[model samples]
Target: MSGRFDRRVMVVTGAAQGIGRRVAELAAAEGARLVLVDIADYVQGVAADLRDQGADVLALQADLEAWEGAESVMARAHERFGRIDILINNVGGTIWAQPYEHYTPAQIQKEIQRSLFPTLWCCRAVLPHMVDQQAGVIVNVSSVATRGLMRVPYGAAKGGVNALTVNLAYEYAGQGIRVNATAPGGTEAPPRLTPRNTEAQSEQAQAWYQRLIDQTNAHSFMHRYGTLDEQAAPILFLASDAASYLTGTVLPVAGGDLG
Candidate 1:
């Protein structure tokens, strides 16, 4: 079946599992030549599975939280694929759930590092290439949690992402680069293979986490979590020619939450 991404070179970060992996899978099915990146070594297995399904794929292990990592990923991806047509920045997530006061300074910094720097650095690194070619698409995976409780730091980071998306789209539109974001609400997926946090949750901590979940459902107009496909579909659309005229738009996948 002919697909929207036929022969397109697409780079997906955080592709080891969850939303990132699902994006890779769907893109591959649509004929994308994939560069799947994650710090986890097991991303190679994800690449292997796609290869077995007759897709052109390359997997790289890189700590996208670092500038060096983002540069290297783009450099190597362009080297392999000749040109980059799509960049899906999917490397950030919340590592802890708690009130603002409960977090240490170090924890706040870590949250920013994990959820903000990667997107910022990747955009900086990839812009030169996209600008040189005078054509590209960037879709950042942000979150509805930007307005939710129990993850103030993470919310702040995603808020930064939202700002970055609009500003970059404005800066690069003249050069033919379209930048957008998908702000996902609660999504149902398999248990994380590598947990973001390993500490055993105390009763208070567990209660706080549960509260976040309850709040997510209560705020959603649909009153439920979405599936992986629901999240990936909008992301892919933003990355496709179908969204040719759409730029600087943050599409909310959060039922009714405008965040």
Candidate 2:
């Protein structure tokens, strides 16, 4: 593809699988040198496969929940690639769910760390490099759950992502940095969603989970879950120069399912 991102150094977190993996592959195909970071042990294998395809790729196993992890990833990217032109903060996931009274303090904290803190840490780590270069793109991955009613913790964390995107855009827009987010609808993909509806052990609880899934699938104009690639497309586009003039916006790729 003929585009502005050719050979640009790009870092994608949560890249071991799912939306993050697809985003990395597509970015690499577009001629970006990639630093794929994920806490998951499988990131090395994914990096190996991409390298075999002749892409300049590096894989780092890091828990982005730690501030150090975010710093380390950025430092490695600079050490290996010389500069960062795009940073896709694709970390975070739905780590926990429960009624408000049912969640412990520990569980609440874990969910926030899992679904929000990494984005904050990575953004903090990359902003200076972007400002120093006088140019960069940041694509934060949020969730459609933020659009309306959904799981309390996941939705709250994603809502924070949207807030962060807007604030960063305003603060960095004059500095030549673009910040935006993609909120993908629930997907029928592993680690994203699953075929197992009864992961909850209780019969009543499992039934409740199934009902939630059903309602979510029906919320979209298209009554089906999106594929991983489908969810990753907007994120990749925002990470590329194709979206040069876009920032501070949340693009929902939920098949029009914001209801």
Candidate 3:
């Protein structure tokens, strides 16, 4: 497990915390030259912390939902590292939990913006460089919620991620690029440093969120939430040479939930 990456240039988005941060940390342990990116300035603090521990890291803040931001991130990564060997597209999360009908038009749009376009735009932005190198790995963090509970828009966005993974793998295999995704079920991590939603939760909203929790646990064979390491390990596997023969597959990291 040690030194598996051995200085491979890797980019991990949404790397300020959680699964993304874990991936970057583990990869660094294995000798990856990391480019950590997030929309929050706090990602710089994350990078600084990792540097203190003797990792080669460059952290950037960017809104990957926009093309310019995505393009700039990849461009800077390439400029600094010279070649990109792996990309872990780990941005996106559900901001609201409710019945589809309860969501406003703006909320739906934001869900798509938050959960879909970042992966879409980043994939598009990185493909050319990946193609030029003719070898790369992409592991997108999708969700098992694509089949469970109150985040219909988020589910749909992840569905798009699934489709994109398959099609991109088909198109780019000849160029030695592998694209895949991991669908994580309920994960138990620390509270977000920056909450995705700042609005106070109403009783109805709280109930709606509870339903999501119930359904997630009910469907998982383990009937439990997984730890951060449980989720991060599979993602790193998909991004590693250990998965050399794997491509275009969405591996479910949920104990038994296939979503």
Candidate 4:
């Protein structure tokens, strides 16, 4: 409500649902001009709802798994807004929950692709514009599963995200760009309209997923999942100028799990 983002041009990826949707809503409410991107068609409806509330918003449908998709999203943001002040890379999730040895090579690659490539591509695409402008902020959504999970590939990908955040912050500090990440614990939200995996999961897979949930709750001091707002607030904080002194940091919103 403080309008920390007044007049700011912000982009949020994976904005069709869940954490990304919450981020976009909050940012818009706080006075950001937004570009919301998602491969899902639901993103258009999200944008429309914001528009109804008088938010300046652009909804883009793109597959962020490829470099071109990332490039196009950034290009449109710049072309429409003239500059990008913030970017929230919220485009990732664990597609499968199974032991490492149980994962096939194809499954491993798909997991990596789902949970890593989008962030990597978006960062690579957005940097040139930020570097040229000499002012920007990037908030990557990571996960506490890095240290506890049945989803090893997801954990590894998030670990890579943490590393990317630190190094990018250091690399672009002189250019007035700040990069940080948030590692959220298990979160409670509505059932997804579009599930992460389309294939029918076997009984073993269901048990593995349950193990992931149990491990997540057990690792957290709160002993429960986080609300959407709990996860989004820290991301907005990192994006705002209030955190001007903080960069190259991965703040954990994991109820003391500190992954």
Q: Candidates 1 and 4: which is better by lDDT?
A: 1
Predictions in order: lDDT = 0.95, 0.83, 0.93, 0.93
**1-259 in candidate 1: lDDT tens per residue?**
1499999999999999999999999999999999999999989999999999999998999999999999999999999988999999999888999989999999999999999999999999999999999999999999999899999999999999999999999999999999999999999999988999999989999999999999999999999999999999999999999999999999999899877
Off by over 4 Å in 4: none
Model 3 regions lying over 4 Å from their true place: none
TM per prediction: 0.99, 0.92, 0.98, 0.98
Candidates sorted on TM-score, descending: 1, 3, 4, 2
Q: What is the lDDT of candidate 4?
A: 0.93
lDDT for each residue of candidate 2 in 155-244, tens digit (9 for 90 to 100): 888889999999999999999999999988878667533221224457655564576677678788888889988987788888877798
- Model 3, range 1-259, lDDT digits (tens) per residue? 2487988999999999899989988998888899999999889998998888788899999999899999999999999999999999999999999999999999999999988899999999999999999999999999998898899999999999999999999999999999999999999989999999999999999999999999999999889999999998999888888999999999999999999
Off by over 4 Å in 2: 1-4, 147-150, 191-200
What is the alpha-carbon lDDT of model 3 when measured against the actual structure? 0.93
Cα misplacement distance, residue 133 of candidate 2 (Å) = 0.2
User: Residues 185-259, candidate 4, lDDT per residue (tens digit)?
Assistant: 999988997999898999999998899889888888989999999999999999998999999999999888997
For candidate 3, the 10 contiguous residues with the lowest summed lDDT are 1-10
